[model samples]
Target: MKEVTPTDSEEHVRRRVSEKCSVDESPRFSRQQSFGRDIGHAAAETYLVTRLSFNLLGYLGLGYQWITRLLALACYAMLLMPGFLQVAYLYFFSPQVKRSIVYGDQPRNRLDLYLPPTSDGLKPVVIFVTGGAWIIGYKAWGSLLGLQLAERDIIVACLDYRNFPQGTISDMVGDVSHGISFVCKNISAFGGDPNRIYLMGQSAGAHISSCALIEQAIKESRGESISWSVSQIKAYFGLSGGYNLFKLVEHFHNRGLYRSIFLSIMEGKGSLEKFSPGVRLKDPRVKKAASLLHHIVLFHGSADYSIPPEASKTFADALRAVEVKTDIIIYEGKSHTDLFLQDPLRGGKDELFDHIVSMIHAEDSDALTKDAVAPERKRLVPEFLLKLAGKVSPF
Candidate 1:
């Protein structure tokens, strides 16, 4: 072969990076000008269309509130049975769906707990935040997650945080923070180990859960009941979750549904600096506190359709950048919700406690007791981490 030239070496490097990104090529000087123009035009069209739709919706929201309410009520009345049927599937099809609690002021948006039978001692705990793209969701999402943890002898709680139409993402986080504090404080009463609670959520729930860890809710009453340790949180497991609202809005082009759904999440309070996880990293505390190394766990599906894999990938890279201890599980062929509900896990569905058992046993060697880590369950920690150290050393 002829001697490789400097130009050839540069071309090879560019190609390698392009392949890694799964794009034909990086936006480079070599790209034709027409390509940029075409992309700009497409983006402009999308923006204009979305802006018009949002403008129209603003009018409808302001001028037709009662009309819309009546229509919505009529629809709900017609679909009440279907709604109930959907709930039945959630209860029967999903093992994690457990009981609800009337803990919040509104009562409708209250907390719920799901705990497995455990001995008198304290066991690990996992707090679940459900996802409804920030608009609609319920406390039952955490039930399935809680039951799994219970089977592993680790307690689980599915919280009911304030939702949109009445709260922002910041407000939701505040609600969750209180919810977390409430649930943790009462774990002992519910037969749980308050010291070992982990904050977990999916999608929008994950976003607010992240906010809860980073930002303290507007000065809440702190008491002995609110005592918690980040170390004890162990980690955050975000399944196709953790969408940076700023980037998410950009990713979806500020469309009507996207805006209504997302803006409603934050009470129209989203700021670039406040909403994006990547941007938030610029803050000293976020950079210092963020990482699987500290007390966060990240889970994402490589082929997720609801949210891009890059959502987790972006946060994962950030965690790695800080040398924080974070673990990510990318279900190679799984989608967004698959990682949550019982689906084809390793090709077959399992009992309600499958994921919880895996997560707890994952660190069995580091656990106080193998039986306690998961008791009779299997390990959920990464295989490499498990094999790297033959013994358990959680610290």
Candidate 2:
């Protein structure tokens, strides 16, 4: 009924076209038209499709991320199950264990001592140190080890030292020294024998313990006061440790996770030589103390990709070359973590565990008979007999 002018007709057509479009389609059409005007229709269509695909991918990526995280958590949970069970048994089941005994002023300088159920007398001691690449270690990591040794009637001293980013390698090693001193001075009350102490460490812990021993040896040679005697260490057990820092740096230079940590631990260039056990073992000071090295035992997993078995082999060879009594134990088809998980209670057994029990048994036997001396100590018998003969009147 209204008059149809050209301008009125044009306005009516525009309003009708807008009403026909859906809400989302209207904005997309406007954008496409603007883009088409600037960069042809074909190119604008391609851009719109690409944008749509990107938005869809973003939504899908979020779900994929969560799925990956769940898978990783599942894997970790399975790996930690064995250690968790051991720790649970130690805390809830074992009642004789003394825990959180402070050794130094720092909070991290505490240790746990696991005493055998039968407190008949002083027991052979094993001081264990757990590894965390010198960066991440907790005293709880040694709970399984302490329980294992305690079951064999050996006193177990599990130590916790300051970790990196909180303390430097020097501080970490110092904590170990302080802990050893404390153990030597006070372990008798806990049923631990000061004379029959064995030093055992795994991975980064091995490096720290070895360094502490080497340092102690150096101190004794220089007539410095050492809280504990090098001879008191009946044997040194190093498991999956990298003795040569120089080589370790070279080996892991490009590794994304370890490279930065190694660089931080070493401090700067040329500092690796200072902390390297293999390098220091060859030093004149350490060589002088080699005679007091006693028995050294090294364990390595052949299938370990994190740290090759060659590291242990090279270190054992070095010790042998220096005339130190050394033994190497190899675990075939075992990964780095497999060494700890191979618990008899976990439905598996490790050869190194048996070797440790033997060491403790042998040490205990020596203590029961004062006349018995280790085969390595046979050379000192002549002097011991001479002193005995002088003390006796008429035999």
Candidate 3:
């Protein structure tokens, strides 16, 4: 891990601001520049929506079950539009956000950073991978979480990678690994503590990140050279993610992700064992690799039929069997998006969010003190709308 002093951190920030200003300044053609940027953003949004619509239609034919579920999902989204729009605005225009930082040579190898206001001391960092099944994941999906964590003085790096058709499971894992390597090496320049970095992923992202972490540990156990070490990571947090693909194949198939489509996303049935973190941990050869891991934490909702809480429970059991320090927290009656999206948007006090913040601030008395007195976040959507959205949510 690289150590950075206060002076070094300040100087780095100054250089970065100077460079950004140089690139951003266009006073002579300000009007034209603004018009061009708006046009570009509009085009990008159109392309994204069109692509997602086509992909979703392709996978889920026009079956009655899918059509009904799609209708419900759309209703859920509509009910939460107020919150979504607010979050989208912050994600695209917030001064605290640094968007589209390239991490690799691939077209989609980019990430967005959410930074805290004060850079006095090194802040704990989280490299978050957002969930969008396996076909629609994007870094912007993490903006809400990033904004909340940044307010509590934590740095967040939300990563983007190639989704299905464009890239398979192997490609996604490789992209995440590369993103982690970049953060582990370069975060110090951004006033992030290299020693306190955490890895977190939601839904499909959870599975992809776990595969990358386990694969890295395996490589290290074999004395293979690597860019980043598992030891460098403080902990791994899996949020509503499926660990054993074999157990989830049928579950996902029934939920609109057909087996054939899911199989192809996982690169066929032969790769199931290779990608399943829970199953891979049972292998004798991986014991040494597993021992290298610091801690594993899994969070899930008891009512999440999308993947089921049993997935986290079983994975936790496997981690303990391997002698890895592990903990699983189940939110009773909470749905998949409730813990990740609705709860955060509903705003006041969130048990899951509190738990995460408590863990991150355990060793810092001052940080914990600040967190305890922090003002409650204002609700983005009305209580009635939130309730309606929850009832209509397909996930």
* lDDT of candidate 2 over 1-395, digit per residue (tens): 11211122334522432332223456768566544543552354357446544653443344543345345535554544544655655543355566555677874777777877777787889999898767557666787777766766788888989766667788888899888877776666566788888998988899899988888888887788877888888899998888888777756544322455566766755667777777777776677887778899999889776578888998888888889999999988666665764333343344677678776677356433532332211121133333332232110
| Better lDDT candidate (1, 2) | 2
lDDT-wise, the better of 2 and 3 is 3
Q: Sum up the clashes in candidate 3.
A: 0
Off by over 4 Å in 2: 1-74, 363-395
Once model 2 is optimally superposed onto the true structure by TM-score, how far is the C-alpha of residue 91 displaced, in angstroms? 2.4
Global lDDT of each model?
0.55, 0.68, 0.88
lDDT of 3: 0.88
Q: Candidate 2: lDDT over CA atoms? A: 0.68
lDDT of 1 at 390: 20
lDDT of 3 at 366: 98
Total clashing pairs for each candidate = 23, 0, 0
Candidates in order, TM-scores: namely 0.62, 0.71, 0.92
- Tens digit of lDDT per residue, candidate 1, span 1-395? 01211123334422432332244445573244434644564476457446544654553365443345445435433433333344445443342333344334542345555555545566677788888656555676555455445655676777776555545666677677766665655556555666566778888788877777655311121212333434546666776775466667645433234545455545564364575665566556554445323545677777665578888888877766766666766777655544664241122344323554566556555443544444343223333432232222110
Cα lDDT tens digits, model 3, 1-395, are 12222223445543654343245557656546544754675587569657767876786677776778778988999999999999987876676887766678875787889999888899999999999888878898899999999999999999999888678999999999999998888888788999999999999999999999999999999999998999989999999999999999999889888888899999999999999999999999999999999989999999999989999999999999999999999999999999999999999999988988888888999999999999998899999999999988989
> Is 2 or 3 the stronger prediction by TM-score?
3
